[model samples]
Target chain A: MEIALLLIVGGVVVGTFGSLLGLGGGVLLVPLLTLGFNLPLREAVGVSLVCVIVTSGASASVFLDRGVANLRLGMALELFTAIGALLGGTIAFLLDERLVAGLFALVLIYAATTMLRLKPAASEDVATPTGEGPTGAPAPAGRLMAGLSGPNYRVRAPIAGATGGVFAGTLSAILGIGGGLVMVPLMHIAMGVPLRIATATSNLMIGVTASASAIVYLLRGGIDPYAAAPSAVGVFVGAAVGSRLAHRVDVRVLRVLFAGVLAWTAFLMLRRAAGLG
Target chain B: MSASRPGGTLEIRLAQLLRIGTYGAVILVGLGTALMVINGRSPLDVAPPLDPSRLVSDVLGGRPAGFIWLGVLLALATPTARVIAALRAFIRAGEREMTIVAGSILIVIALGVVAGTAGG
Candidate 1:
């Protein structure tokens, strides 16, 4: 009963904020599980991955409907993200728990700093056309460049996007957050994707990226649905609500608060890594 | 409304599929959660590790833990399913490069699943 309550509550909080920030909230959940609940890092990671999928499903579904999600862009980038996730999952099983903890701490700290420095998202230009012509169907592209670039805008940095995707995927699997923490900024800063598009695209891809890692954890018998189920439920619901409320909230304030949480979590993770916990 | 938006039909279909999957998973998981709470103990509470096959069987057998596991699987599968849908849509649209990219992603996912089984 207690565990169920904890998981559900934790999931709701994580899901709400995660959706608001265009993230999976795994970073927050990992620390919560490890410090508050005292679960092993790996177990927490397993649970976090499940919740990540739930959040992804909930938010991305809406983003797609609104045309905020760029499918072509997401698909193009997912190649490297999936590859990285596969490698990350394998390494997680092989690496020392403490090392993973230390790395997770670094991820948290990085997430905090990034959130702190993140500029306000550029204006909402998410309603990009879907390339439906007068005939109400899309035109066929004959070449590789056209296909890769898609119909929205040209992707300026395929190489950079791939590198960022790889980094995001590995960190996502290892840290349990949606790779959006890495992806959103990478797209905005390095790839020159608009902020709204960057976040939407990140949201769309996070699910596929997490799925790759989740399979490895599931096959390894690492994922515990009992621990993850209620949380997943809460997160799904919370993400729905968050998406609705996102526009009303002050993003800067939220980022500051989230950064604080990340900082604290980073401290806890580092403490555990140092064997103090 | 730039020149880079994907085919509208493809995006809509993928979104619809994902939404349906999310709803389905949530409903199943919610039902199982209610049962678990009422029963006062979950199969996963301090239980031994089980693989995907056993988990599916148990879920099919109407066990609460099984339902939860089924839900999680559905949630995980939703995105991969989206990717598959996109791949098909791209192929139908004759976007050869995109088809290859989607196919490669699927292959990677397949490899990950295989690795999980092997590593486990």
Candidate 2:
């Protein structure tokens, strides 16, 4: 009951703020379950995985209908992420909780810095149809579209998308950060995807990434169905509600607010890592 | 022509659907706000012992700043936010790969649950 109650509440936040800010619920939920509830680190991470699955799965359809998510890019990247997730989950089983926590804090700090420095710029509107590797040189031949730029910005996204997917999978299994914060910025700054598009697409990929590891957790018997059930239901409800309002709200403000929260969360995570809090 | 507009055309079709969704969302938001104001609601928290009520009050411009954090999540997690993101993707790239990816993730979730319980 306690887990369900807590997760249901958390579901609302994940469904709302995740879509609003382009992050996965895992980033917040893992830390909260571990520190606030005194759950074992691995178990907390396992639980966070379920939350991400529920919320993203329920909300992604709306994102799909609206066409905000870039499905092909996300999937092409997932083959890498799925591998990363398997490795990360294995590492979680091997790692010391303290080490994981410390890494978590460090990762959070990095994400915060990126968020703070994020510049609102024009969508490149350029599509590279080349199914090729990331190269430093110009996109070859018919693959080149318009480059997204500000004064010092031109991100090669396909490469970053693949790499970021691996990172998110690893983090999800290890520190339980979900890596959405990382994926969003990378997609925007490196891949040149629009912020909203990045966020939507990120959400789309999350369930798949989490599910990859979720199976591992289940096999290990880390999940508590009683807790995961109601929470998943709640997340579905919240995601439904959030999808309806995706357009009316101002997203930049939401980003600013979410970044602030993450900053604070980083502080808390650091404290927990140090056994100071 | 169905009932609400009685005039079948592109304009009415779009407008009617728009109004239903818009008004429905407003009512939902209003209902949530009213519940908070009138019923002494406790905002959602992933783990308690960390007052969400205060956070809600702070974020929504409600009294006492009771639940600022909760308000933040509530505002962020709406279906609207998710839809906007999804819509943007389709418009930008014209693909449904996201749907497959989400499905893949859920399978991992099931695995995690089974593993956690067995391990626990």
Candidate 3:
């Protein structure tokens, strides 16, 4: 009973912040379940994925409607990400959960470090559009680039987007945090998408991307509906509220706090792995 | 090291500092994993709590950690795209910069790989 309440409360916290910062909040979810609720890593990851997908879906919808998310750009990139995800998902089906956790900790460390060092500031004018036709208007012209690839649909720009998605898909399946960690950066740099747009797009796609792998896990009986249900409920609420308030918050400070939490979690995970807990 | 070009030396030092900081963070996490292994501790989180959902995990005893990293990267692609879009929005501010973002994320992935393996 207490655990049930705890899940909701935990979900509220994770969802709310998750929405606000656009974080997968899976980082928060994993430790909360494992350390606080005593769930096995596998179960925790499964539950975490379900919650993450719901929240991401809700958030993504908002961004998509806003026209900030480029469907052509995203879909084009998904080509590579989908393949990468398939391979990664297959690997996940074949690996152990603890090692997954350890890798997660390491990824957090990497993410936080990257976050600290990475300057989202654009360094060049690569966005100079040719003909500058549609200012502040939706240009379906992006669709034209999809087929302009090198011999045939091998366009370099589209490949960058695909690469981003491919990596994001693989990471989501393996880590359960939905792979926004990989997506945000790759899209920003490789594909030349704006950071804000990339995050919004990534959050939007997480549900579908996660669901794709989730299907595999479900078929294999990896999903526990009970755990997924409550988690989904909690995170969905959190994500909704978080998205509404995202712009109002101080992003830099929130990120710092998030990074700190990740570092601390890594410490705890290490302690647990070493039996120090 | 240069007395004449104080600002230039400082800029060089800052770049060096950030890179070192990035690697140092990775190394610390790696060492922790090494310590755990040396202590004969296992890496699996076998039976996580029931309330937290036991659905999607890879089960440590029988799986590889690389799969997890790969999954994380893929699932995050879209949201990461938004974040990049957000970053790229700064391009409108007139100083577009993707290098720092890319470099930072790459460092994280590389570091993540290092620490993840040590614990495994």
Q: Comparing candidate 1 with candidate 3, which one achieves the higher DockQ?
A: 1
- Best candidate, lDDT: 1
Q: Write the per-residue lDDT of candidate 3 for residues A154-208, one digit (tens) a residue.
A: 1234444666667777877676776677776676555555556666656755654
- Residue B116, model 3, lDDT: 30
Clash totals, every prediction: 8, 81, 96
Ranking by DockQ: 1, 2, 3
> How much DockQ does model 2 earn?
0.08
TM-scores of the models, in the order given? 0.90, 0.64, 0.61
Per residue, candidate 1 scores C-alpha lDDT tens digits across B1-120 of 222254366677787898999899988888778778887875247643655568768767766777787787788899889888878776777777788899999999999988898998
Best by DockQ: 1
Q: Report the lDDT of model 1 for residue A49.
A: 88
DockQ of model 3 vs. true complex: 0.02
Candidate 1 vs 2: which has more DockQ: 1
lDDT of 3 by residue, B5-92 (tens): 1123322332233223322322322332333334343333232222213213522332222222222333333333433443343244
Task: Report the Cα lDDT for residue A97, model 3.
Answer: 62
Error of 1 at B31 (Å): 2.0
Error of 1 at B107 (Å): 0.4
In model 3, what is the error at residue A210, expressed in angstroms?
0.4
